[model samples]
Target: MRVETVLLKDYTTLGVGGPAKLWTVETPEDLKRATEAPYRILGNGSNLLVSDQGVKERVIRLGGVFQTYDLRGWVGAGALLPLLVKEAAEAGLSGLEGLLGIPAQVGGAVKMNAGTRFGEMADALEAVEVFHGGRFEVFRPEELGFGYRTSRLPEGGIVTRVRLRLKERPKEEIQRRLQEVDQARKGQPKKKSAGCAFKNPPGQSAGRLIDQLGLKGLRVGGAMVSLEHGNFIVNLGNARFEEVMALVRRIQEEVPLELEWEVWA
Candidate 1:
């Protein structure tokens, strides 16, 4: 394991945050060392909001062997979701194409049940291997208690790997499906912003509600709601963490939608 002091802004898609001490763990020994101390998991650095004051605990990131994966079976927790989608499409594997365009790592995606209207991570997940309570244990989908944009990964458990069950489709067909999903995602903003600021809240669309409330283009200091998508709050170059949170609070006051991203306060 190795440690570094860094500006947390550089690690998030939002381009905001303060300084922190980060620890990158490689093998099980490294993970064990990290577990021995109080640390927070850094998952892909997307869909997160960190306070400008930063965090007190050491941040843990998975690396080395944990970044590796197998197409049909076990996959490292640190595997990139977009890469997984591309590999699945190229390998003629179906199911994962629906998650194309999501910016996330395997562990984060599963922990939050990440997905689009096409499907969620729970749809293809079979089981997971996690290290907790001084030992490694396997947890099945039934035990996960998966929900919309949420999952129970076992308290204090660090996900090491996961197993997926997918169907075989024609490679060309899966590739085409990926393209379609990408096109569907074109409406998402290209600026620096955490994917979506709020969950859709059952059958109602959070974005539509925010738009209806005329909250788009709203600004709090350097942070502003995206003109293209009401669900996104973009960083106007120098947005601070609290500036973004201010807008989040404003949106919640105007609507009942809950946050889709994590707030490191």
Candidate 2:
């Protein structure tokens, strides 16, 4: 295990946070020891918000052995989602292109069931391996209770690996779909953001609702509602966690929307 004090902002996509002690564990044994006390496991820090007053719990990041993966559809939890999608495409496997442009680790995607309109991580997942309570267990998709941006992963569990069920398809076809997804995401904000700030309620679009409410470009400190996508809050150079939360509160006051990202304070 490697221990270091890190600025949380440097690790997260939103670029807003204080500092915390980070532990990078290279193996399962290292991870087990790191989680023996009060700790929080982080993936790519893509969908998180840490406060200006960062928490005291040790932040755990996976490394070394946890980054190893194969084209046979088995992947380490620490592997980046986009890398896996690209690799699957090269292998002529079809099923994971939905995550092509997502900024997340494989494990994070599974935890959030990250996906586009076509499909979700759960659809390609055959089994998940996780460590909790000093032991590891495997779960099949049917047992995971996957839904919109959600999963029934065990509380406090750290995902170690995942096995995907992909189909043999032409590489060109997979590449074409990946290109389409890339094209579709061009409307997303290019600034630092944690993707959609609010979850869409059943039968309604959160972004559309925010747009209708005329909340675009609403600013609080250095944080602002994205002009390109109403569901996003972007960091204009130096955003603070409080500033982002203020914008969140402002949106909530006018729209009955809940947060889609996690907040750690």
Candidate 3:
């Protein structure tokens, strides 16, 4: 186990935020020991935007043994999503290909029910092993209450491992699906961002709504809305957390449609 005062920007994709007390746990025992107090479980930090004032809660990150996985569809919480997708493909697995380019870990993906239009993590999730309430327990899909861009995984529950049941598909077919997912993402901006800044409202696309409002290319300090995809807010240079939230607030206040925040701050 390791603990240090680390800048939140270094852990997040947005490259902004203040310092935090980070705890890196390499073993299950370390995880148990670190859970004695209130803490936040951070995965790949892909869909997070920390405040410039920083967080008071200690941040826990899984590592070492937690990063290992196997072909039978057993994956650790720290296992990168893209790497798991590649491994699943090589093993003739199919359900995870649609999430090819997502920058998240297995635990985070499962918690958020992360997915594209084609599929979601829930489609492949068989069981989840989480360390919570001072004990480890396995939860079935029905227990998660999966829904659009969300899951009810209990507030303090820390997902440790996940079991997936992917369909056996021809490697060629799986590769083609992955290629299509990659191709679809080409239209999105390739800049420093926490993926989509806003969640798609029911029966409507957030990008389309923002585009319809002519809000693309909007800027606040060093943060700006991506012209490529209106749903994305990019960090041009030294973006601040307040600036990003300011832009988000502007959109929410000005736009008639209610825009839900996707990035956790």
TM-score of 3: 0.96
Better of 1 and 2 by lDDT: 2
Model 2, range 5-105, lDDT digits (tens) per residue? 99999999989888899999998889889998899878898899999998799999989878888757568999998888888898899999877788999
Candidate 1 Cα deviation (angstroms), residue 145? 0.5
lDDT of 3 at 214: 94
1-265: candidate 3 lDDT, tens digit per residue: 9999998899888887787889999998999998887788888888888888778888899998788887575689999998988888988988898787889988889888888887888988889998889888999998989998789887689889988888898999998998888888788888899888777877888889999899999999999999999989999989998899889898887665543334445
- The lDDT leader among the candidates is 2
Worst 10 residues of 2 by lDDT: 65-74
Evaluate all candidate structures by whole-model CA lDDT and list the values in order. Answer: 0.89, 0.89, 0.86
Clashing pairs in 3: none
Error of 3 at 83 (Å): 0.4
Give the clash count for model 3. Answer: 0
CA lDDT of 118 in candidate 1? 89
In order of lDDT, best first, we have 2, 1, 3
By summed lDDT, the worst window of 10 consecutive residues in model 1 runs over: 31-40
Which segments of candidate 2 are over 4 A away from where they belong?
none
